[model samples]
Target: MYAIERFESRCKKAIESILKRSVELEVPPPEIGALFALPCHGLSKYPEELAGELASKLESLDIDLVGKIEARGAYVNFFPSGEFYEIVLREILQKGDDYGSGEKKDEVIVIDFSSPNVAKPMSVGHLRSTIIGQSLYNILTFLGYKCIGDNHLGDWGTQFGALLAAFELWGNEEELESDPIRHLFELYVKFHRESEKNERLEELAREKFRLLESGSEREKELWKRFVDLSLREFQRIYDLLGVKFDYVLGESFYYSRAKRLVQRALEQGIAKISKGVVVIPLEEFGLPPLVIQKSDETTLYSTRDLATIEYRLEEFSPSKMIYVVGAEQKLYFKQLFAAARKLGFNCNFVHVDFGLVTIGGEKMSTRRGKVVLLEDLLREAIAKAKQVIEERNPLLQNSDEIAKIVGIGAVIFNDLKGDRIQQVDFDLNRMLNFEGDSCPYVQYAYVRGRSILRTAGVTKVTLESVELLSDYEKKLIELLSFFPRIVKLAAETLKPHYIAQYLLDLAESFNSFYTHCRVIGSPNEATRLAIVSATTHVLKSGLSLLNIRAPEMM
Candidate 1:
């Protein structure tokens, strides 16, 4: 247990004992359970005379670990002793890399994210689900939950039907073989354009999809080719981002299972054919009806999604299944979840929806080919990172490697630094800027701390060498004490932005300490160096949880 946690526990025990003996209260109010709540403030639930007595009793307790306790009318404030800081620092040094890790949890959690559709090039719009999902995986794993990062690929849909129809109409064999994904993407865009003019194209596309679902060998072979080509291209982007998934289950993987699932739903009277389309009416759940199968008998995403929930439950029996999707699909997920309940699979379904990513204030649209491809954005960012490195540190070795780290890290940090539900506008210059609340700024702080540690040559720090702290030291220590809590909070809330904001604050605090305090030549050199050492470890660990690299020097 951390020093602050232990102290808080002791205070709670003391307060409970005091209230039980003096106030004759059988049950403590919820406020009393809050951290650092004024004892007398919650005691006001009782009579005024009794609350005063309880406060007086708390002040007279024989505990000195807190150093002092004062009762100011309807409030009691306790100040932690100096030994608290010493123990916290000692424990941090003792734990080192394992400071914020929690005990193993006996529950499994499945995270489904980064599911870009096959044949569509990954774009800036895909950034949030990919990195956010990876970050949540890191945090939950650190907190000891058995996390399964599943990349649920979008390989089956009406969109693919359109792509197939387009390819058969105008696709060139040499063009497709030379550049499969781009060729397929252009064909998809063309299908939508042509269908807008001639409605017959829409019917043709639906028939092609129906043929594909009915196992036409030709259509199946073409679908496999698209899947193979798209996955290879997607892997390159995943490699550059340093993301990995335990499973890459596409919608096709669940398509056949969805047929059986829909049959079962029909047998159970959970669904019915309405106007030749199968749907589950969910008015009681405050959601619109969920379409399971189209009028042409081709399955929809809802059918596959329910199958996904069923498969995950029977396979992993996860305590929770999180879908990291865009905010536009909020209603779709609600309908899916409600349909799942109707189907009698009662698993925890969470939709972690995030706002859309716009490029220069324009919403990305693949149908119009107006989206910025993720591969292009990454390459441009890395090139710009190389240019900045050359200008800042001409003598730096392995600058290429460092630029990738900084550039990619900046893009990821920008995505995570704001609220998940807020729209993210891409601006590489702002993200890579080293002077503000960007990844480079935080990385630079880490580099500076590392330089200080290397110069000090202090391999270890002990409580014996530490003494009284100045305001700067005290501020840093107080901030450091919150690291463990911050990590746990990020895990619980499923928000990586909390960790991002915390790192920015820590970097700002460390910079302040560096400016106002002397370390190497000061009389409290060992003490200040300890602070620097701990800060670096935390900065590195926090960045790692966000799936960002912390370079030694940037």
Candidate 2:
């Protein structure tokens, strides 16, 4: 068990014993089970009559794990004993990388995120979903949950039709070889421009899509090429971000199953045909009717989503299905989940909606091309990071590698350091700052701790001399002991920012300890070294959960 758990148990046991000794206790003890910080204002929900009795009883009881116990009004507070700090330090050094993890669970969790469209360039809009999903995956896996990250690619729909028409009309073989996505994007933009002037061009695109859907030999081959080119381009970005998936299935992957699922829903009367379109009416649930098929008999997003859920249920039997999508699609997920339940999918469904990423207080629109490409954002971040590295640590080796880690880490940390539901403005200047609450700051703390250990040249740690510890040292140990609880809370709440914020707090505590307590020339140098070692390991582990790297020197 963790130090915090042990402390809570001991404190509860002490309170129970005190209540048992009381003779005027007509009712049982007010369940003084929860662990609260010292100097609590009052014990909420406890009877006012027993306030004095409770305080008097708690004051008489002696708990070895608790260094100090205070009873103010009806509230009881407990502070950790010196032995508590010793146990925390020992556990951290022994557990090392596995310090913050929990026992394994036998349930599978499937996370769906980063469903970038095939024919379009990945924009900044997809950033939140990608990073947030990856963070959740890492946290759940750390806590010993079976996790499968599925990248549900947008490989079907009208966009592909537009791309196919654009290629036939304006695509060049040489330009495609040079840069497929950019070339395809330009052609796609041109097609939309031409379609406005010639309305017939729109019909041509629709017909082309119909041909592709019906398995036309030529159109199918072209459609496959577009998917192949998009996947190859998307892979480069995914590699740079250090993200991978167990399944890279797309909307087209469910095409074969979607029709059957929709037909069954219609047969069961869960979905009905209205005006030649198949939809599930959810007005009772305060959501719009979920359209599974268009009037022209074409499968829509709802169809594919339902099909994906069905496939997952049969194959993985996941206990939960989490969709990390934009807040704009809040209603869409509400409708999708409602439809899934109506269709008899009994698994837990969670829609992790995140706020939008705006540039200069303006929403991004891919249709107007008023958006920053994710690749460009990453490149600019790397360049800025390189400049910082050159200015701060010019003589450092592997400058390029370190710059990449810091640059990418800055971008990710900036996105994750706030409440997931709050809007994020992509501010490179603020994100790259080395002094503030940024990735560089936490990473620098780790580097500084390592530098201390290296200078001391202490290969082993001895706890025998740790007879006396300062307030700063004890506080640092207390913060270290809370790592496992923090991780568990983050996973339970499906919020990565909790981990991000905790790292910042832990870094602040470590910095305080480093400032006041000298580790190298201290009376208990070996004990201090152990503390420093534990801090470095924890910082690295915490950063890893956020999918960031902790450099030895920054």
Q: lDDT per prediction?
A: 0.84, 0.84
As a whole number from 0 to 100, the lDDT of residue 487 in candidate 1 is: 90
lDDT string for model 2 (440-531, tens) is 98998999999998898865555654658887887788788878888988998999999899899889989999999888887878888989
TM-score of each: 0.92, 0.93
Model 2: colliding residue pairs: none
What's model 2's TM-score?
Answer: 0.93
| Candidate 1: Cα lDDT at 528 | 85
Candidate of highest TM-score: 2
Specify the poorest-scoring 10-residue window by lDDT in model 2: 21-30
